[model samples]
Target: MKKKNKSKWLVPVLGLALLAPTVLPTSASATPAKKVTSVEFVGMPAPATAQDMARVYSGASVKVTYDDGTIKSFPLTYKTLFKSTDVINGTPAGVAVDVHGKPIMDRSVPDKPVPFVSDDPDSNSLMKIDGAKPTGLGGNPLSLITHYEYITSDQSGKSAYGIIPASMSLSTIDQNKATGELSVTDVKKVDFSSVGGLWIPCNGSLTPWNTHLSSEEYDADARAYEADPAQTYVSSFTKNYYQDDKKVGNPYAYGYIPEVTVHADHRATVVKHYSMGRFSHELGRVAPDRRTVFFGDDGSNTMMFLYVADKAEDLSAGTLYAAKWIQTSDENGGTANLKWIKLGHATDNEVKAYIDKGIKFSDIFEAADHDTPGFTKIKTYPSGKLEWLKVKPGMEKAAAFLESRRYGAIMGATAEFNKMEGVAVNSKDKKLYVAMSYVEKSMEKDIKGTDASDDIQVKKIKAGVTYEISLEGHQQDKDNNKINSEFVPSLMKGLIVGEDLPKADEKGNTAVVDKVANPDNLSYSESMRTLFIGEDSGMHANNFVWAYNVDTKKLSRILSLPAGAEATGLQSVDHYNGFSYIMSNLQHPGDEMIIPEPLKTEVEGYINQNFDNKRSGLVGYISGLPSLEIKKWKNTNKPDVTLQVAAKANGAKVTWNNKEHTVTVEKGVNKMVLKVGERFVEINGETFELPSEIRVKKGRTTLPADLLDSFFR
Candidate 1:
């Protein structure tokens, strides 16, 4: 990996460059230093004894109090479940062959985690395992269940579907399940070569029928032109995938949800659901009734959508609808009334027929002006303009089904939902939880407007918030054709929003880390009544997985990842071998080293070279550097006391004296002075001792950064 020299400063510390002065007799000094009784040094505050340091450091148990005054404690442990490299080696031989008939090389995995555990209703009956104490297909009293891993790809050359069967086994199953441990085992990958090349496969739902419903996120508009060379209405964002004469097949063949069913024989079959409508699908959440499904779009300024199937078990035929937001109030956290606007209805065959004809998917909706009989104008909401497509005569009604987002916008659906992510349903309260990684002010518009002009200016700081929409008292239309219920949506919870938290430096930037921000994938466990939230956030240095209690509105940190890593596919699983599991993916960790020994020299050099004069900034701020510590100067003779920095801001201040070649640390009226190149310090003119002499390297001063915490206390 190539290294980039991004930052100029090395690290934060306090140091001074001093020149040697002519020697003077002890009694001949001009001004005599006054001696005082005692001296106190100002230093950083220490963490209270009550703080749970162990919980944050190791996989120890911690209790979190919710906003509603409810309490729940659990031991936090994050196991690597599986890595991308593991899946490559785990694939059965002769299963996947490349374009040249050679075995496909190992590929990287993306962020989709779908489980097929023994306790899952669909997998239980299919695998002939008792749901109560289910075992794996291998029958070793299965501790870990089967799960599917979806790999998103920008390259068309790699395989997108890989499965890890029985990745982890539970060591024990008991009432204290959270305390139970899991032992990982070698698992093989089940390849889905029949699905063809999948592009940007994202999050999806575990279907009511016990199958995996994975989504295809990005679609190339250029694919539409390839299907119909005469097409004129293609979106400008489409990429020309066939430019290099790559025979990678049709682009229109991708972008829909591929339902995969893994049989007891360990073979899998994938079927793309054209009827579910194609867009940048984030994921789908199936309703308990099985007919209605909620889907989130993972693009900027996108729409929230749903599909109603003709049958409870099948998704091959359905009517798609987009949410229309009706602002009830102007407050940021106020409730908004939601109504669903019908886009269109079509079966998989009918949609395929339109694609077979000369009808490009983009031709279904009016992207720009100048076309006759363009999209029909629909009722407008404050969010944006709404219109429905005017399907050309003799054209199959599948245009709306293929370009679902465009059709939904034309039908008066609100497209202001910024990055609509994971969707989960609360079976007990009949509420749907929608995770919007970014909630913009524009989504709160109350008046109708045209799609041509922009009304709401995007804000600089965007925080992740979860909305709770009540689905109570839903009633069908008189014709029994559509549901005519108003969805009242209120801000259920907000992450990383407050005055104390740092804001993003620029609009849409993700540099600042608040308490919690950018909540992504969500999974709700009915039995535990807890919602597991995984983060795909750039705002935080280390992304974390959180557990929130729906009833009590309490949230707690369950797991965290290293730098540049994201917590993906967080889900609450059923008890197995006496343990309940929360499965998640730690994606793409950064190069930051976690161990101390190898980094000791590098860290010490950084502190000596880069300790800036500015004191109030993040650099040299004790709280900012969580891993800072003090150590003995290399090859130092004297040894006694050392300074340590604390976490609080009101710590001690150290001053460097250039003329006298000395260092002084002060806390209010008290002071301690240490001469340059000496191991002893004078406390209020009284001799004091130190563990080592003040060291200097490369013309810069050095000291143990953390040892200052002791004097302040």
Candidate 2:
């Protein structure tokens, strides 16, 4: 086995942040804001907690009290923007469409997680929120905020959820300017025809430039496509996406990052960042500097990937690096020093050109199942799969980005990480946190430990552990070439580890309760100094969303997902319009798995009673508090959510042009334009940035509430 570098482990200390001040709203309403000291959710009777495995909370609720001891609590709902089953604009609810904007009605998955399948792998795990993008709002309540959300796929085939297409819904949300409470007003699936359609888009993060950066997980094996281009599952995807069985989908296209740009017209355009290496991407999450990105490859035998763009906030071009883990200790979730092997630099179009030229894996590497004379023996992917591979002389760039995992391994980078999931950054601590959902398989020593080929050898944590990568500037790659970005990962060690219960506690519990078990999705609030961890575990009957205060090191259970459901869609916004937001969503619930006996039966009954049709999940936010409150319009005889800015409330005439997808504000001699989906408005065809965009909702034109009082005057 080949080793990338010979660097020993460097011990690193976990630095904790100082406790942040209480987040209290500054609105002078004579009512004092309640600071959240800690939050605890009412856990359902389920496994691990020694509760009934099947029982789930139906009318879930959250109670908030004021500083003066005035108490008020609302039920779990009354705030849900929409369920996966909610149809808007009279369309099919959450229909999964292919590349051509054609619905692939037969794409399905069985309830519960699948161990493994031939081409399709595990589709049932957790639902990731991918973070919510708030448009047209800077900080403070004077500006009403608009939100957009996305949920990606877990590649399921043939079941009740076939229409949901791994299932993605882009819900349009409206935020109460004063309270920071978010509610869904519109929901629709993003069209993907312009960019070869989305392929298994997984989790994502909102870029600092205010765009959505999402992943396409479980990339179809390119080798399989090369052998029988017209007979593989990818071909089927092409048929579904293009609505033509004759169309064979390109394997090179599905694995890269798909960046979504939202326009003022309620439309989105997608572009694939081929510059980012391909694999089972859980995320291509950007660091604070905006130039650096860390990818989570979510499968067994994957490499830890990092990419630094040539320019800040531009992912179209970058130099990629893969980490070679050098173990220093095998105790306490292990410890490692990381050395990066510099992958060749390229732009998006550079690699896409090769892909367009029909570059094959053989074009990049020479591979064999056994030790052929010239082939290098390496175990790079899956749990036990082995390959003898050698990179082609002139195809360096192709090997680096197109067949990245194999190429990284061939170049001697460590490729034994397992179930490497979500990644998040604590800019304050200058640290990066990543989730390894299952610390097993290749992460163990025996997989490829012989030649230091498999450098990570930590005790398996079936319930999982969240690893922290210490970030520092002035670092260099394994070759001692200076790294371009300041956020290079230096030392890595487990920050939050889950413990296992001695045995199953009736409810089929295997992990200790009151602690993190199978930590998955993560988002950090810089102002709050807290890291939110979501779980996708079979060890617990009910998955949970935990808020880990990094400064105080307190693990608080803020919310509990339904029984048999996975906790996902975790994101933290420090402040948007003066109010902070914690974005969250649960994937599929009501599936029977892992739990035993009466618990399963009870859960099945409960699932049938609660889960609407067993296909819908939820997209919502954490409630109760924010830091500021803008006054709401008196709202006399208006809808729960209405376009009630000052102009609309005062009865000003606004016209909507469906053909142009624009809203015209007519005030004699004031011939100007405010466009939707765009944060800018044109005054007499001269464009200028607006604090917020002009949007058309409910067939009516609406300008930012804060703008209404000033723009037209």
Candidate 3:
């Protein structure tokens, strides 16, 4: 990585007020939110008392007793957010409530904890509302607050763990956008025991039956720790279908299970589904028909995969498939076709074969004192209705079979396949999008001859290009946003404009049309499928959110993201207004800095560097800096993310600092026109000075770090 050095300054934490807060709303709102169907208490931090943390967490349900005498149950899940001495106890319990007041029950051990159990006085988890916040309304009703963690395994035996948590907020976020702040508390820790296991951030899809289809993303070497039934750290979460009637503890009604470790001895909350292929998955989404599920493997050499649950509802027993893009080059403008390849049979025998080949069973057998031997027998899988694929007649059956055979080779998949990350469906559009990273393509170019005299020589020309896929109307919602549109092929034609496409100068006087879509006028097939490609590495290494147009058999809009940003997950929800949430790890261009290792030293240095004024505004113009510009910056573009900011001044002087980037607009007098060679910026009329040199890059420009220097000074 080329280290870019620039000035970095820290702003007062108070500046965080500039960002909007994220509040999850309840189903009663204009947009009905996804109801909280269930809740489970995972490993809780050691509580101060010996009482099982699960008991307090699972049983608690808060009720708001409004002044009107109307009572509403608040969804709450008590869990250890962080094991910190900050609280008197090692296990500090924080309540995570689904603001939407979705019901919760234990799926694994069902037939016990029933709804309305909140009314029971014996429950430790019920929240009794004594009074509302003082707005002069003593008995007025208020909303409940909860928290949850986005966690994953280290996969590397190194023990380091990453945990991302959203800031605590009342569920009514839309209403609180003005005063509420959407912040993410992040912590990366390294410890012991849980080391080396693959971390699973299972972004499960909503099944037709309203259950989640959660899949596992395991590390390849996870089996090294196991002796027999070689486990590679894959876990599954299935709906156990059991409803707990007793007000005892957990009311999941359905529970998630870690089946890969063969730790079956440890009673699992749920069973594993071997039918879904094992890999490092970020998220998975099922097709409308609910028969086909598309998933992406995270990390290098990731490949797009699909699992055709023989029985859509019964994903436990089904054949898995991988998508293979048919590479082609012809006058019809080189085409890419997705071919489905079967991974394994739905039978338990096939699953056992994977185990025999070093997949561990002990990972699922929690009771095993030590690792055991590999077991290979279809007998291990429970007999159940297995889902199968329904292939169309006159289709490329041979090609599909051939592709399946090739993908079935796990070893080959590791060696030959590239990483395919981020699979999403635009529910409204009925299109699916998959993202690939660091993909290279050749761009034809013509060079002049070396002869100085006369003849212009043509040089052999080929340039490598990396791009994302944009499939029109493939991943659409039930209502149909793009797929159902009357403007079909023609609208799709102009979707993806090449990078070199001509654009007039800043003046917009000239027409620059370099290249057009490789294959224009693409029409969707009956099965409008799509994929999104997110590149993690390479030169011009950008994380692109590309969509594939299955109908036209070509890529459509190629959303080029800032360098180093990865679009890891996607969710198109009608619940959160009309917005498609794109979860990304894009480094924010502002709010960054470099401090010395020693806490005292870095602080002293930072203070001295700005002469006691640590703000960026104090520093004078640093020259030779490259300006960062974002042509398409939008708050809705990135949902559920913490923004970082970076910048540069004149003369290409650069600073790669990390500052809290705010999306909230600042209060200002008015807007004005830009003069020739003039830069635009906001300043506190009372305390700030104009930066000596500020240049705005066309489209989107990186806010200068000196803005802080100029103000703080």
| TM-score, every prediction | 0.58, 0.73, 0.35
Q: Assess the local accuracy of residue 383 in candidate 2 as a C-alpha lDDT between 0 and 100.
A: 25
Q: What is the full ranking by lDDT, best candidate first?
A: 2, 1, 3
lDDT of 1 by residue, 1-713 (tens): 53432321111111010111111112211122222211111121211121221111123243433232323222333443323333323432112233222233333334532222111000111111133232232222222223222322223223232221111111111111111223333333334344443344567667767776767665544333555633421221112212223333444555677676655444445677888887777777788878788887876657777788888879888877766666554343334666666776778777766655645545554333333355554322211233444655543355567666655665556666667788888877787887777665444443455442232233323556666777644544223354633332222323323111354332222444334467778887775466767666766545566657666666655564543345555555443322334556543343222223333234323322321110000000001100011112222332323332332354667666789677777665344556667654443222323455676555455543323323343
Descending-TM-score candidate ranking: 2, 1, 3
lDDT of 3 by residue, 1-713 (tens): 53323332211111111212122112121111112221111111212221221011222222222232322232222122122111112211221112122222212234554221010000000011233232222222222122111221122212111111111212111212222112213211111112111133333443444433343333333223233212321111111111222312111111121221111121112244544655555455566656666665544333455555565456665555554444443211123444434444454334534444442323222222232333111100011111112222332222122223212322122212223344445554655544332121111111332111111111111111222233333433212322322111111111232332143332111212122211101111122233323233222222233334433434422233222222222222111111112222121111111111343243334333422121111100001100011011112222221112221221122222224221222222211111213222222111111222233345333333323222222
TM-score of predicted structure 3:
0.35
Worst 10 residues of 1 by lDDT: 614-623
The C-alpha stretches of model 1 lying farther than 4 A from their native spots are 1-74, 87-193, 222-248, 356-359, 362-390, 394-396, 441-461, 476-481, 484-514, 591-713
lDDT of 3: 0.26
Clashes of each: 25, 15, 152
lDDT of 2 by residue, 484-535 (tens): 9889998999889888888987666699867789888888877556788888
Model 2: lDDT to the true structure: 0.62
Which parts of model 2 are misplaced by more than 4 Å? 1-79, 107-167, 228-232, 382-384, 447-452, 626-713
Instruction: Give the alpha-carbon lDDT of every model.
Output: 0.45, 0.62, 0.26
State which candidate has the highest lDDT: 2
